[model samples]
Target: MEDPAQRRVDYGDRSFDEADLAACPLEQFQRWYSAAVDSGEPEPNAMTLATAGPDGPSARTVLLKGVDARGFVLYTNQRSRKARAIAHEPRVALLLVWHGTHRQVAVRGRAEVLPRAETEAYFASRPYGSRIGAWASEQSEPIASAAGLHEREAQLRRRFPDTGSPGDVPAPPHWGGYLVRAVEVEFWQGRTSRLHDRLVLLSRDGSPAALDDGAAWRLERRQP
Candidate 1:
């Protein structure tokens, strides 16, 4: 029994200057997000979602479904452990990593369920199998066996035979979306000698209004 390999890799000298920051944090996020995508980063939209309940903290990775003037969007089952935790405590955190580009973003925010119409539109756009999965798997729920899970999938398939036209697959009653309106956001860029660049933006009232208006957020640099 021993520690893992100890190898240190020196980072690049990239910098994130306050002068070049976008008027709104969402705009800045779009720029960095596009960079990650153009660099061919694997699953560039994947994000780590952290939630807390009365018991303790929980974390899981979920794909970034969308982003707009308001905030970051992701879809999940309403009965999920994360959703339950969010109901108990609406505060949550999100982390996005672009290791190949030596960049990362951490966001502390409050999660809110999206409007039903918005969720329906997003759900209708998903692949047919994924739409079926929304109905088949009671996310975060224990099952007796693998066969049992497959059985549920089989039932869903029979209910919706056309896999090409996902629109025909009704959105599950318990599946929808959440918008994380950032209260605070930090962007980190790796630099040489372990010194990194950290820039943070804070919303005045920790609400979407403060997040999107540009003038309501205070921006500052943090020591690495």
Candidate 2:
């Protein structure tokens, strides 16, 4: 087996300072996100969501579907482990890694389920097959076989055949979205010798606030 420790690459020296940051983390994130996209980074919106419940801490990668002053948004089956964990404990964390840009963002926040209207709206925008799959698969549940899953999906497709209209299939009741209201947001930029630059924005009151509320936030530089 190859020795994983033998592999190494120096992260080019890049500095991200307060002077380069936007007044708000969301805006800064948007700037970085745009840069990442322009650099041809694949799946730039992919983020790791971490949740804690009675059992323990759990983390999974979920695609960021929306973002704005409200916070980062993602969709999933409400009955899934992550959803259940959120139900047990709304406090959660998120990590967005953009390897191509040698940058990452970390967020500590609370997850709130988006309203049904918003969830349905986003669900309707998904691919036709994805809508059917949402109905066919019971997220987080054990399945007998891959064939069985495919068969269930096939059955759903027949029941709700695509009619060239997105409304042909509706989002399942268990499927919805969550908004992560970030109280603390940290932006990291890799640098040479692991002396990374870390800048964090924290809510003045230690509570979640809109990303545009610059007056209610404080920015701090942290040791890498």
Candidate 3:
């Protein structure tokens, strides 16, 4: 097997400076996120979520459904491996890569399970087919075959004949959202000769306002 890293591709394109970044890390993240979407990147909300478990760390790509001052929010089946990992270790890390734009955001923080009401609201708002699929599939669980999945889907379809009605779809107890309260946020911008710009913001007591007046977060530049 070839080591992909050995195949070097020079990243001598763009440069970033501390003076050009947003005062708050979240703002900078938004700027990059918007660019990612505008650039036609597939699934711009997709991010690699890393969680620690007994064996080691596990990572999976999950869609970022929400983000705000509270942090980044993603949903998953409660019985999934990632959810179990979160139960054991509340801390989590998220890596968002926009290769088209040569930008990345690394976030580390604590994850909290959102309340049932919030989960239900989000669940009800999903597309009808997605809601049905959520009910039909036992995520991260072993299945007999592809036919089994189709059979399960058939059964769900019969149970909930009307797809458009929210009444036909109930939020699965195993499905919910987890909010990552970021304590550390790093923004990386690729530059020429690998002299990339790396700016980090560290939160004080999980508060975004702490970065205000230079008291909330300490900003630093790292050598690329």
Best by lDDT: 2
True lDDT of residue 208, candidate 1: 48
Steric overlap count per candidate: 0, 0, 3
Candidate 1: regions farther than 4 A off: 1-5, 206-210
TM-score, one value per model: 0.94, 0.98, 0.91
Model 1 TM-score, all chains together: 0.94
lDDT (tens digit, per residue) of candidate 3 on 153-187: 98988888865777678988889999988888899
What global local distance difference test value does model 1 have? 0.88
Candidate 1 residue-wise lDDT, 1-224, digit = tens: 54557767777788778887888888888889999999899899999999997778999999999888778899999999999999999999999999888899999988999999999998988888888888999899899999999998998889888757757798988899999988898888899987898999988766645444689788889999
65-166 per-residue lDDT for model 2 (tens digits): 989999999999999999999999999999999988999999999999999999999988999999998998898999999999999999999999999898
Provide the lDDT at 74 for model 2: 96
* Ranking according to lDDT, highest score first: 2, 1, 3
Q: Ten-residue segment with the worst summed lDDT in candidate 2?
A: 6-15
TM-score of 3: 0.91
lDDT of each: 0.88, 0.93, 0.85
The local lDDT score (0 to 100) that residue 196 gets in candidate 3 is 89
